[model samples]
Target chain A: MHIQATGNVYRAKAVTGIKTVTDILMFGAGGHAAAVSDVIRDIEDFNISGVIDDSPSLQGKCLFGSTVIGGRQQLYMNGLDTMAIFLGIGDNLTRARIARSLGGREFPVLVHPTAHIGTNVSLGEGTVVMPRAIIENGARVGAHCIINNGAVVGHGSVVGDYSHVSGNAVLAGGVNLGERCLIGIGGCVLPNVAIGQDSIVSAGSVANRSAPERHYIMSPGSRIFRRFEK
Target chain B: MHIQATGNVYRAKAVTGIKTVTDILMFGAGGHAAAVSDVIRDIEDFNISGVIDDSPSLQGKCLFGSTVIGGRQQLYMNGLDTMAIFLGIGDNLTRARIARSLGGREFPVLVHPTAHIGTNVSLGEGTVVMPRAIIENGARVGAHCIINNGAVVGHGSVVGDYSHVSGNAVLAGGVNLGERCLIGIGGCVLPNVAIGQDSIVSAGSVANRSAPERHYIMSPGSRIFRRFEK
Candidate 1:
């Protein structure tokens, strides 16, 4: 099996040609993890074996009725190759770091039943699409990304690896987002606009034009989009 | 049947005690009409008899495979009581005017199959909830309102009559919106903020505080919400 790599951002692919339901392990135990667990339950294609959070306090605890078995060290247990890992972390940087460190593991893409994913859309592995999100036709979302609740990735839009498109945000048609970026809650990226790597389109902000790496795009006044120093 | 009335906005209740499938008439034939048609097709409860548009050119034309039967005058033709009227107009005042002019008609509430309407939610008659919109638990949406695509009315929020919550907007939990209000596209109203009647929260803006009647709320700079002259 050939795997692609870029820095710490490895591009994971969906497990294909599998006949039976697979046992999946969740990698984090946060609010986003709970949401992903809900989606997993809704999808019903995989059995959630247990949660694997690194925190010692969460050890032996429960998340959404799933037992928190242990930390990442548990992945090395018997039958590791058969069990798939789900990236449930919400932070982009931390998720990307985990993805890079944890190599050669299957990361299946999970999408909620209520989400509207149009034809010709491509979702990379480890990406979790929340309930009621709309991914219009011909859109592409990269690996380990979080397309949060009711977010709209417009037609032909491309979201890079480890990005988070927050709740109720709208990336207009043909918009492009680089890796590790965040399109905040209720954020609006105008049609065909491209946002660079590590940039943040602040909550309730609008991005009308393209911006460079590590910039902060926000709305200054009514219906205006401007770039400010981060 | 005892029907309740409040000025021009009579609260139309959902048709009850009907065993057989009923025919439904769409009231408008614009872009919003097209979206409402999509939702109707998804729900598959009522048969769409035809469309009623005021435009002369649209007469005899087809909307989502349904014939544009005629204007409001055609409603007087035959068997009107059996057929239910769906408010498909996007404009608040226009929809309210038509609702007022056409009295003694049954207006059933329409919600899309993809939408997540939480427990204890109360949706009034003639209200159309578009695809992927979310109405959280205990929320109340008044008569003839439009909850557009991917919009979110948070938990326990109350939205009044004839209002339009546009695409991707988010009204946080406990928010109250008065009649004929417009929460524009990508707008975010903070938790417990009460917007007055006929008020407008501009697109991509955020309302952190409550405002009185007929005012405009907009977000300036990154996260500050303020009132402006409409």
Candidate 2:
């Protein structure tokens, strides 16, 4: 039941003719959902019809002006075949699990207008690239990934499915991130480094070398280089 | 002789009418120059006329397809009044000194079209905001600064004159960076922290506390938190 993007279907589109606005259902209601909602509002191609959250309390509540229409039950409604869905969740494993649960649903790529996606890049289905994020030329971002605000996926890099490159994180050129990995806030993976599935480069941490699956990088152990004269 | 930007004259312009391309002179031919030139090519407002480097060997050489026409002498040439100048240098002290040397010349603010400058953001004269950089709401970036590639000047942050926020660096909300400071690549300044003049937060470092003038913060000495089975 895992929904893999067939071909280059989710690549960013260049609108050459009349604009068509597609109604999309946002799949979460957390902080990550709010961030993706902001980006979706900025992009001209997508209209947020409703937010889908499983919480009974949130069901009928307003999320960023969109109605919390219903939960996974709405997925069974007719007319879902024509509508697109976007995963606004941030957690790697949870996002991956939910993405796998969907059956043949159209998951469209949502890229903020301010984000720069270079030529020859392949963005997989249901991936949401946030404001000011950069995916350099020839990079491949797998399905259901979140390239968060100001994050950089450098040239020729491969971000496996369901990975989250958090705000301001930098995956330097040719770095490979395995499925369900989370590069935390302000984390940096140095050039050509490869981290396996479920690995984490912690916030403000630098991964200068590769690590195997499920490794955690602890960092920002500071030293005062110079306390200058007053 | 220091050329101060009069009023809000250097703000990013919205071209609604017929496009008029301004011929711009690049002030340096270094690596920073190449980066800014790449951004300028993406924005449709300005055309790169030539490059100016003080290095004698670089004179008449090519920089990113622009000819290294001449050095400081071109600053006084006829028709110079119409051409805009951009300081393509990265060094904080050197950029400041050179900016002060120019008198009455128009130093335009060059922001890549892909960069997101939010409401009420003020980018100072001669400042170059590189690709995918973000200046959030009510933030004020000072004159002649480099907000480098994928760098985030968070909401309400203040970056003082001649500073460089390096690639993928994050200045969290309300962070204050003083004049001639350098926040290195992947450096993260935590929310509301203030670093005084000539300070440096080194690459991959996190400045979680305020520092006084001329301080150097070093970081990213790492440790393994968890290593998993292959």
Q: For model 2, which pairs clash? A: none
C-alpha RMSD between model 1 and the true structure: 10.0
Docking class of 2: acceptable
iRMSD (1 decimal) for each model = 7.8, 3.3
B1-230, model 2: which lDDT tens digit per residue? Answer: 12232233233432212234478889987645765665675665778899988789998886667899888887788876557688888789988888898856678777766567777777677787777677888898888888988788999999999999978888999999999999877988999999999999987988999999999998736665665665
lDDT of 1: 0.78
DockQ comparisons of all candidates to the true complex = 0.17, 0.29
Query: Over all chains combined, what TM-score does candidate 1 have?
Result: 0.59
lDDT tens digits by residue: candidate 1, A1-230? 21222221111222322333468899998656765765675566777899998899999986666799998888888875458889888789999999998888778777766677777777787888777787887888998999888889999999999999988889999999999999877888999999999999977888999999999997664432222222
Q: In terms of TM-score, how similar is model 2 to the real structure?
A: 0.62
When summed lDDT is taken over every stretch of 10 residues in candidate 2 chain A, the lowest stretch is: A1-10
